[model samples]
Target chain A: MAQQEFDTTAFRNALGSFTTGVTIITATAPDGTPVGLTANSFNSVSLDPPMVLWSLAKTSLSVEAFNEAKHWNVHVLSQEQQDLSNTFASRGENKFAGIDLEEGLSDAPLIPDCSARFQCRNMVTHDGGDHLIYIGEVLNFDQQDLPPLVFQQGQYAMTARKPWEGVELSSEPKAPECSYNEDLLGYLLGRSHFQMLFRMRKVFDEQAHEDSHFFALSVLNIQANLSLEEINDYIEYTGHSLTDTDIEFLISQELIEKLDDETYQLTANGRETSLLHIAQAKAIEEELIRDLGQGDVMALKLLLKRLISKTDPGLPDLWKAKETAK
Target chain B: MAQQEFDTTAFRNALGSFTTGVTIITATAPDGTPVGLTANSFNSVSLDPPMVLWSLAKTSLSVEAFNEAKHWNVHVLSQEQQDLSNTFASRGENKFAGIDLEEGLSDAPLIPDCSARFQCRNMVTHDGGDHLIYIGEVLNFDQQDLPPLVFQQGQYAMTARKPWEGVELSSEPKAPECSYNEDLLGYLLGRSHFQMLFRMRKVFDEQAHEDSHFFALSVLNIQANLSLEEINDYIEYTGHSLTDTDIEFLISQELIEKLDDETYQLTANGRETSLLHIAQAKAIEEELIRDLGQGDVMALKLLLKRLISKTDPGLPDLWKAKETAK
Candidate 1:
């Protein structure tokens, strides 16, 4: 197959679809001086040992201070702290000159009314692209319930606690198109290990001779369109107990019929029986519902139903019906 | 060296210091059914190919729909779209019961008034732990100038748009029990790419066999009090560079004194030079500021400085004038 080239601009813009928080790491120089920089590359690496990590460019001046300092601090900004994000990000001579701060554990500077704070020791450095990873072992920390500042799509933003109402009041834009088949399949497999059954049938079909008597009746019991020989091979693959006697009994009852030597098929009556297989899928669905609770399940189901309707305009009653019964 | 352990919770909480935006992924099933799911694990992979990627749990029902889907839609939440996030995250049969949506190029569901939207074709899938990575080729997308929803530390947060009118702050913590010498040494070496100078000194020292003049000078340059031959190799391992001509120049300038062929040391003037090196670092702190304009840089810097001060109660002013200037 010919390879298709990938467009990174479109891709990055696509991924920018998700938003994240912003932070600034700060440390003191040897002569008791402070240095800092803004970073969104910060992440939690461990919790038990009270560790966190952030990445800085190898050429950053603050990096030297951080590496040399006995301790450093991380500040979580509140939605009202946009000015703070700007200060540390600028090339100013005295960022803290007019900033509000208080002394905390080990005399660390703490901004009043910020969301959270973490004082830590440098852990180790890791190699990142033109950057050095700094892991900090949190020695002390604190937090408030204030809202946090967000960053997405190259812009600073804030989180909204409320849900979206029916109408588009703000006028942002439409989302990109995406197919939901894969998500549905994933849910199916998770809910009912059906993929195992599908694979089993394939394996059984491979083992059977060109024309041979197999568990044709069971295959008919599941997916009735298959030939009797195909059914037998599938039964073998799925490890279901089937014998020639059962095949004869099924034939006698008119649930199956012989098409030719080593070839057989499911009768009309057998096709009707397979509808129960779909019902079997409900057991898994019910289990998921029970685990998630009625409210959560209802939410997920509704979202999915709406999404499905977007694809096929005809599923007008998808939400109205509990099950899509055949 | 002994192996060290890290704490995951502490790390996560520390990194939660940052905030980000939220978005929902929408797609259709193989048989033309629609489905959608809430996701924050989306990020830009590349810009040139116009490709974007996100990870879906292998167990998500929407995963299956997404896999066989011809197109997918992404909806970036707005500041007022908290309800939208809740609706998308909840499990229900009629998520869009009272919602308004428009048809895009592929008839993909467009959540009206979102911060942004992107329609893309399924590009590729890669195996991830308990998830599959789906890459998309963005066909079309849109955006609006509105704040996006953000989630951090498992809570909703908004962007901090301005600096708090407050007092200046400083580092509070007293020095740790551990001596600051190692930190000082690490800081000095991190300043410049002087490793080549160290390499030249290494070659000369090996050849001279007599008290290597180059090694003696490097030790004196940084730690003037150290006797040349008595300097520890462990300290030398961290040093980056020295040159024979540089060493000779320092001695000629009375910056160092050679006690004998086997002994040498730094004079008073050399110690003052080391202090000046760290001071020059402040002007070029934001080396990692990529593809950002001056306005963005200033805003980010200001915000970062404020946040850092808020987080570290013991942080001192990183820039302090020399009190012992000659």
Candidate 2:
């Protein structure tokens, strides 16, 4: 790791270990052309003087315009701006052609819907190896509630914030020798799934429906007019199969009707019940988004989807379009 | 937000929206006293020169020590070093009493087991409002595989890195008007849980055991001796209650034996089976840790625990200490 014999790729990889927020620094050229590029080098330098700093590669095409510009704006991008980040990161022409800009303290482009923004006047420029560091005094700044996008290890990321104190499931820690503990991924996933279902159980209990009956109704709601055997293929992974008695019970409750001796479809009452389940599930999710921040919930869903894809056992696709003839 | 009359709290909050990796900057005083403090303002400034910068409040107690020091070390804290971060953050005595220092290129007190470490020579100190910015030229640096600790919006956080492309569960985009999609948190959780269990089912199938029998055995393994009602109390949330028929089936398989025809305990074969399940679960988890990075899996577990705690329905604790007399 000698400074004189530094390996460029290794150094970049080591530097990438330090995570940073994504930002797009924008400046206006002498001809009134808006130039912007994605950078994660932005950092707050001072508070009382309201200063910030960011470095740019000397070889960048926008370097000359940025050097001549008197003012520039830093937009801390939100998670929703990944596409915009990619566009500005490349040598795309007319980057701001379709963008609607907001008025700011300077002539620099002010992009809307950012987590934070800093309008600054260039105060000084310092030599930093192959890059030039631009220090500025912030003239005005604003913030929004959107979650900032993060970059780490050369990939985009999102943060699942740990509370200041910490999140504890039990009042006391589990015994060390216990075979199963709260830390087990299996236990955590099962508990989360069942607890969510527990809330929906109250709704189903009103109609004297068991868990298997609910599963059957949910399947019918998606791909209608399916035989009992076909519906079971989609739910066999759940370890609960509907018996003939369970189908008969659902028919007795007016939740399903026989299209033929083998095929079945949801009745009007059954469709209403299934829709109620979906609505309740959405309501519970809304509460979660409120409890946990939207970004954390999004990360959770992303990881869960990945897990599902990795562990899938060749189950039939639940959302695939059914045959029109059927 | 005028710079002259800026509200300090709001400004600080706005700056915090720019996420950063946590670092502990350390240097030795004239009398050889080790001083360090947590700072999130660390950022890389150059690659060719291998330079980095961080700012410290001018009013800090270690200001004089740092000002006089010719060299300092920057430690990028890992997720496992949260306690060390807190200790250095406070004005505590003997912050380095128990820490094991690693030899570095400079005399700066280098801490061991950090995600990354940079031994730097103090290049320049710039006036930054009420703070002093230290720009250091790195002489040598090293990095580990540990996940870096993150700070965002005034709270500690962990990151779940998204792949370069993205995570898409389905092959095609879902219909806009569909009632249920892969985006549903409930559906994701259930699918994730069942899919994980589906893999474990292959192991269980070798023994001709059903999912409900496995659940019952899991409960019996923990509590040793339990009546059928007691076991059902723990397994009911799973929507699988143990019945007399289930107990008879287990007896027929020689997996369990009845004590006074009421209390039930696992036979030697049953204990072996339960232990095998635990090992299989752990192996599956290891594969997940490989597929999803360890940090992302950790974040998923944290979010799941929070979700379970929020939605808990007062189920009896399975790991509670049982009465020895009983």
Candidate 3:
């Protein structure tokens, strides 16, 4: 039988939904020539004594260099560093060409204009599918004052603060003029995944037993901008039941409006109703984060990262071993 | 202590370092009227039997309605639904005025045109700082294919794809036309909290010893776009080290250029140098994702979702009890 082929594009697209930053993993070849490649797969391993990890494909040109090199460097890029992300990402390019070079405390060529730079000795390497995972111990580092870059949806992008809350705190003296007066209210009203169980309790709420339409409305509202087919596909994924008549009923009521023949949007009335719930929801989130603190937050982040990586066809075996060990 | 007067701007900005989406949570008052507010602290909870949770201020007018209400609805707004999010989030002024509504399956008025919706019963509420966290058990849900509206930098926006992949897959059918391009690269490239430990590996590459200046150069490149004050702040936060001259040396090299002396961006040459090692770092990511099968993938997502909620402050004790049972 022909080898089972995987749809790389599908995998990429699915993973692309997750956002990450770009970094350059660098090591020296046996002959002392620097070898490196771009990566966004870097993450932290521990805080005490400071440890970090990144991955490298077994078939990559620099694989041998990474395997034998006793030390490595990871450069975190700034928001304005797309050119660097591109240069290192491309294969066979004179990665070092036209770039001025300087050495770090550990003797690696320091990346000019990076958001942050870390120097470390190769701690260990583990086997991941089609790649070798490298862990490092920190020796020294450099820092810069710049917004970090983010990668998502198959492109390099800048991170935006979610309106009123997430902007740089220092910029508060000059808060941007905001007209979206009810921003906080909207957050409280938006329905989230957990609401599924709540809809069930509505059975006890009514004078006459009725199936809750909150989910239905929210589903339709959520699916508003999608085409009918896309909406259906999403409905199928989320396991919602809506007859064509039900959809047409929503349309007739002017709760939803067609953006295009294929796409639809929520009417003004639709948004107000939805916003009512999302506000309360947000207050809950803030409470959780504040209560959890850093330890739980870090654990949560690590577990979530592992979960996302598992979805990809290319997970590391050692990580699996670690999980199994647990 | 005089209520511990706090700088609202400072507190708001400091917390903005974390990113989240905007949402609105709503519930019918005992009188059968609606109440709502906006928030960004919304997240998914249980996937099995789908559940979602959000928080509300304990002192808000909606608190009474929320406490008495047997069920509530959550609406996830789409990017275009910001107006809707705004409407339900506002105070008084008859939110229902000028709003269109469709009766939900449970006879509650459903907001039209949201990204998604969920109807659930109010299962539990917890006391949190200045807020009441409520967890709803989701019984019904809706989803759409539209991009969610993003609130970032005090503006309404849509998510832009991250960089580092090809725009198109094999010219096969069913592929979505990629909306991302280099022109939008500036919007995509930098919003990551790269682990300090991971960054250290890049700082101590063996090559850094060969060229002491390289590490400094890389750090300076990143700093070019940032103010000196900002750089110092970041270093303090991350515990990184560098001297004033190291910064000066980078400026002298012209590799890191300042834009209008207010912000800095890496020169093309600077980017090239930075990319040298980054490409190799991502190879492991590709490999790991490729190795995992679909089952492992699903399990990973579920586990992560559960773990993430565990850290949430808004989760009801009942739901947490259920999670522990698993």
Candidate 4:
């Protein structure tokens, strides 16, 4: 495989294109020491015999233990176990340090909180160049609904499921040619954002507050005693600016009070109003987390933050401003 | 390993938890016919020797062809290749029917437009219980910039890469406890949406058109001669509604004209205005695609559409309205 013209880096990059789930395979050494290493080479073999297989480098410190071990446990790690996967990936002295494992069907170590687990009996070992392929027969296994952690191109990743038929915004066919279609990213983002905000508007409308008023109050709730100009600086990116009359409206409602000629602060009532709005926002997000699995929500938030970061103007960070003041 | 009490279905389900990239392993038969099968069991074996391995069931129709073959090719599939993956997955005749393959170093068929491709010489074959593992030495390989297709839990999926440091909106620490943190999905959705909208506001401000005016014109642009009430019915979900004064303003500006006592339609100038705004939105999205990568933008759109679907407040379909009227 290694020719004089072979570019090792390119070959590695080519191989990395194959995505896989991160796994931690564990086994007990002859001296009863637990050894484990992170691998993405794990794959199922046959369903009729309940078989699976994984490969380990011959140079690995745990390869001898795995070769002699009659049983080993395969932990299909959940997204929550990224740190655990990292820990086992390195050749540390005690990869399983300070960790508790569940009792498996064999002497092999069992890592808990995995997406799935397979208690496998060693069936065969074969040479795979510099690695040894271990074929196993799973005697017992269990699984959790936890989302699995993914690895691709030498980096960790997360998967968003594409439903069998595909996800469509319009129940009807797409918008006609040469017009705004449902597939437009901008339209989808705007529609989703406003639809969600519609639910929170009920809370805002409870006190006859407007969208600009909500922005001003939420900012005041986080970073207190800001001048009208400073508050607008934080929110002007939203295409909504708090006007003098908007501030006056809040004062008239006793939701906010004038700190000085130039500054305003949320009154106790205003703070409560802001918190109510925040709570409603959280409730909506909670419902989303339930509707979209936690993993999908995490992915959504991550993608949103990335989009914001890439598109961010020089808007002041409200939370950071407060921290800086303190 | 298969105990009498072992539940084969559950074991299979557990095995499916490990996500994998789809691949098509192809080899030329003894009689020179091309044979291939879709598999997710393909994985890199060793970097030093540049080895890879995949498992095939002995019962597979093409198993003998693969076993006797001396060279093979593995194609790591891109998201666009899902149909091809499904095609080779079935045991149908002429699996490569009407297919054009790229020239390769080996006699094995080479598929184009995959995320990555590896041409390899047979290194060794190992026997497991019901399956045979083929280890190959990679003689040549190549990769493309396309995003790989993922398979997990019996469904097709797309992966969103997680940055090494993770994504955060604020450089400062998160909002303190007992308050709204930046992780709330609603706030993120709102901020991202408005920030994106802010870019288009420059175009709107030039025309002195408000958000509601833009919405009304866009509706009228698509479905002609909409009454004010009918137009508001569509934009109302956006937390914005056009008032009679707003429609009168559009008419005053000659952007729209009165079709009847209660109906309004966009003037040529009004349709052009809407089209300009849509073009600006698309331009912004194209910039995002360049910045965030097309795949990330796609994932964002998918997650947003799903969020919208779940949180939709029964807004009238703008595009669907036209079709129904026809």
Worst 10 residues of 1 chain B by lDDT: B182-191
Mind giving the per-residue lDDT tens digits that candidate 1 earns over A107-159?
Answer: 44556766777777776665443565566667777777565666666566433
Q: Give lDDT for model 2.
A: 0.87
Better of 1 and 4 by DockQ: 4
lDDT of 3 by residue, A1-326 (tens): 12223444443443333334578877678897877788866654433344556666667888887888888888877666777777888886568787676676555566777766667788676554455656676566555645555554455544422333322212123312231111111111111122322332333223221122333444444334555554544333222345666557666766566675566666786555444333333343345446433222222333233323333233122111112222
DockQ-based CAPRI category assigned to the predicted complex of candidate 1: incorrect
Candidate 1 chain A weakest ten by summed lDDT: A179-188
Best by DockQ: 2
Clashing pairs in 2: none
lDDT of 1 at A272: 40
User: RMSD, each candidate, Å?
Assistant: 35.7, 2.2, 32.6, 2.6
What's the distance in Å from true for residue B321, model 3?
43
Candidate 4 residues A145-226, lDDT tens each? Answer: 9989999888898888777877776667777656878887777878988888899998888888788898888888878878
lDDT of 4 by residue, B1-326 (tens): 33647787888789889999999999999999999999998988888788999989889999999989999999999999999999999988887887788999979999999999999999888876678888999998999999888899998888777888888777778876457778888888888888888888888999898888887877887788677788888888887899889978998999999975667888888888889988898899989988877777877888887888889888887876554452
**What digit string (tens of lDDT, one per residue) describes model 3 on residues B1-326?**
01233444433332232223456677777687777666654544343334455666566778898888877776666655666767766775577667687666453346667656666666676543455556666556565544455443235433433314423211233212222111111101100012211232353343332122443333443334555554443332122334566555555665456677564556776565554423322333234334532222222233223323443234222111112222
Output DockQ, candidate 2: 0.70
Ranking by lDDT: 2, 4, 1, 3
**Docking level of model 4:** medium
Identify the runs in model 1 with alpha carbons over 4 angstroms from their true place: A1-20, A25-37, A41-75, A78-84, A87-147, A150-326, B1-17, B43-53, B67-71, B79-81, B94-101, B105-108, B121-137, B145-326
